[model samples]
Target: MDIYSKAIKVFGKETQLIKAVEELSELQKEICKFLISRTGNVEEEIADVKIMIRQLEKVFDKEIIQKWEEEKIKRLSKVCEVVECAKKN
Candidate 1:
């Protein structure tokens, strides 16, 4: 079975949410380490987070997820644009 199926069999959806939160926390720690020490395993942490997200996708509605993703991209792009404009000022 695939990883998502395996995860479901072992942990179920409820526990998987907790797992996702833990994974995200780990990713945050890795980012903080990178910011402070510049030697963090960011790639590995991102992979872990991605795997958790994939597991989540199995339970969530993909259409809504896609819409949210697009919205986030737009919001982030606007943030970047504002930052760029500030840098030019």
Candidate 2:
């Protein structure tokens, strides 16, 4: 198994889920700090969150998550198009 899968196997799903929450919280704090001071380890926090998110994909339904991601991307694309059009006007 991959490292992420190995981590999930070594640590139970519940523990990993809690860790994911903690990582997300840390990322949120880092973002807030970065916005306030233009200084913080946001990139590192993002990497941590990404790792936890990958583990979460392994723990849950990846296909469903992928579908939702696609839908959200489509919605974001439409919003971007609107913003771009407004910018040109």
Candidate 3:
């Protein structure tokens, strides 16, 4: 599905557009994290990553959405970090 279709599927249209924006942003972030750890074929990997990010931008389309996404990603990391710390300690 295209970005817009995927967004509507995950979150109904009755939901505010901002909610769809947030979900798309989070998806892009997850893809980027996976792309970053690649071991080889940098050119192909970068090309795929750029396309994925551009698709997300088509949905989010604003500075506020970008900033909100970045902040929430940091918060989500804390959740994993805390779980990791508990395992170690």
Among the numbered candidates, top lDDT falls to: 2
Give lDDT tens digits, candidate 1, residues 1-89: 89787997798899998999998999999899999999888999899899989988888987899999999999999999999999999
TM-score of 3: 0.36
Between prediction 1 and prediction 3, the one with superior TM-score is 1
True-structure Cα RMSD, model 2: 0.8
Tens-digit lDDT track for model 3 on 12-79?
55553555455556656666766887434545545555554554565556687789989999999999
Total clashing residue pairs per candidate? 0, 0, 0
Off by over 4 Å in 1: none
**Stretches of candidate 2 exceeding 4 Å from the true structure:** none
* Regions of model 3 farther than 4 Å from truth: 1-46, 55-59
Residue 20 deviation, candidate 2, in Å? 0.4
lDDT of each candidate versus the true structure: 0.91, 0.97, 0.64
User: In terms of lDDT, which candidate is stronger, 1 or 3?
Assistant: 1
Error of 1 at 75 (Å): 2.3
